[model samples]
Target: MSINPRTIRWGILATGRIAENFATDLALVEGSELVAVGSRRLDAANEFAERFGAARAHGSYEELAADPEVDVIYVATPHSRHLDDVMTCLEGGKHVLCEKPLAMNAADAETMIAEARSRGLFFAEAMWTRTNPNIRRMLQMIRDGVIGTPLQVRAELGYAAEAEKTRMWDPELGASALLDMGIYPLTFAFLLLGEPVSIVAAGVLSDQGIDVNAGATLTYANGAVANIAWNQVAWSDNRGTIAGDAGFVEMTSRFHEPTGFSVTRGDQTETYEEHVIGRGYSHEIIEVADCLREGLTQSALLPQDESLAIMKQLDEILRQLGVTPR
Candidate 1:
């Protein structure tokens, strides 16, 4: 956060596909610079930097964290590594935007948040989907009573994931229908209903001890309920919906991304769509820059408390399904 306001310098902490996509979208934003990239392997770092116009490529994450020019670091590693990776950046005096499911569980997530607070640094879970314009409008519309009282919320994200050793299908790495993919549907539900008063979750676990598919019912104290599903076996509709007494709104497939949504009443239905630049990561990038300029630690749009609540829910769901422990 000590970096000047002239141009926000960004350094990516991984050279994976998400890192590449982020760098590409970051370039689409006007006021940020893709200054550096780092990886365990030096060649991978160099290759990512060369492709993305980064000024420096560090062979090790330690090197990237120690870079004097990097004002912020985006942790794109798997969920299991979030705490360690984020702590590295915060201790190095750089702000962080760690990818979603900020850590494997609530305790680790709170630890990350606490560290950032202790260091007086900005830190956020990179839930980029919440930053989309269409989703923002949807939130406003719901608050305006366009959807009446939310009676039910249902969401699901499913796909046949590629077989990967360390990344996917590994319980130790926190791979599961809920943490890896189901989080989108769960997040969609959480944004609308806040935290659930109680949950009943069940799932099918993989041979590696991860849940391949799962379902949960989140009940709110207000008599609202959300039924959500997640899977890695096959692709579902990838849809999300929130239904109220007056009307209902449903986001199209891949609801987590920048996409259109429709609001339906008893006799009328309205659809919405907006054009997004470069796959929508630009929105969160801009949010980070703005927060930095204003000296804010966390974004109002994506708050720390909400992130912690989501993690706590995920941990509970895992326990219910026996993916972790009861």
Candidate 2:
């Protein structure tokens, strides 16, 4: 783990599996320290803190948010509770890096953004893929015209999750393929093409009213289109691609992480290798630390407008698919 003399004190607001992963990644980052963690149960909180070498553990999110030593809080709670948890952290005078799908809807996201703005605090959606090194290179290639005139895109991620009572299948917890797995592919597509003029979507819902699998087609004003899909019903290629008239870029299956990919054009192909540290969450962690140190409130990589736009697309797609967004 890289250590920085100028440290940013961090407080984790949940003790779930994602929290553990994030904590492990944070340990690998420089200029950050996991000072505190919170969970609904004191035992879980203590266990998380002991496992991650955190100095403080709070039984309730309120106590953790109120901790005067924590400069920032990472909200790793369920999607249904994201709005409240983020507000709690912001209200307690701490910056926040909330998990993806920062809120249940665009309206809630707007509220979170406005609250952060009014407080002059740093707030960002933790779309970690946006900070991946290879993703950055791929986007730069597209921006530098490696792919001529982007015309169409395709992204897919799927897995078979059959537990009916778990958070992945329970509508009460805002569970769905779209929010759980689709956001990555959707955000990937949004990075390539801005807001779409129209979106067509279809999906199959489980008995709990959550989407088991869903697909969407986004048509941009520039006539570019993206076909993206996500599911919890079956395993698929889990590949992502960007195709243009001149060339195409392909991310290997499970493109969200630090994985190798390739580019091809005119019978000549080039492959790029990925070398990253610590589950790839460190990039975003370091991004947050850098932003906080520089007094920036948001990241250009994962901007508020982009997050909101993606949320709108998600809401619209779910609406069209007859799924009530919680």
Candidate 3:
């Protein structure tokens, strides 16, 4: 495609649920267009394109990547397939937004990032929370001293998913509570506290060697600590808190896609409610479009280096749990 800065043409490289949600939000992004969709099955691709109003449907991923009308491709495949799929897009000269947990491990993530940087193509792990308005608002407040000096972070996310989904327990698919659910809280802590000085982690692993439940305590250089947990065997409160010297900020349950937040200072508490665009996924879409228009290869909101750092943390956490880092 002759790239149009104002309206970036997008191709969806999968027809899964995440791809559907992303396509839904991509429609809401002002300067983005869903031009094509691809799937292993032509029927599935056609169905997705029809539902999403995409102009073309390709039976194979390569065809979608080679689509001259697509300026960028969204690789919505599972993390296990990310390296190959992302490389395919980059090789075909298409910018990419691969879904979160960018790759199964740091080495693969580094490879994907290096490929994109070498090609001068825009690329980002679609960690949609980083672009959420509520998250951004809270980060700004912390920076503005609303919470003073943050000293601790507590976050947890979990659900009983393995019983119903083979993918949730299958090692071949890189399935685990840590990669699927833990990444959010880990990224949350990283956003508030940066890299940690050291980490102590332990978890319960299934017979298949994937984590069923896990917890980690990260100690930072300035005496700050973040305790994060992830579980696939039960339900959790799913809330998060960042406590600082002067006060604290609490995100409502399901913090990853927070509906609102509250701030407290000694004797006072103030609550904030922000409107989220379609499932809060549209913000990342808007962010990617804006970056493309500005001719940038990365989003400042979720930089490539930060993605790599988080992946390394995940790798370490997995190793601590006695599972070979995927």
**Per-candidate total of colliding backbone pairs:** 0, 0, 1
**Compared with the true structure, what per-residue lDDT tens digits does model 3 show for residues 189-213?**
9999999999999989999888999
What's the best-to-worst order under lDDT? Answer: 3, 2, 1
How high is the CA lDDT of each candidate model? Answer: 0.88, 0.89, 0.93
Against the true structure, what is each candidate's TM-score? 0.97, 0.97, 0.98
Stretches > 4 Å off in candidate 1 = 164-166
Put down candidate 1 lDDT per residue, 65-92, tens digits, no spaces.
Answer: 9999998899998887888888888989
Model 3 stretches with alpha carbons more than 4 Å out: none
* lDDT (Cα) of model 3: 0.93
Instruction: Point to the candidate with the largest lDDT.
Output: 3
Q: Tens-digit lDDT track for model 2 on 165-268?
A: 48887787888889889998899888899788888999898776777888999899888999999998899788899999899999977888747778999899
- On the 0 to 100 scale, the lDDT of residue 197 in model 1 is 93
**In model 2, which runs have C-alpha deviations exceeding 4 angstroms?**
1-5
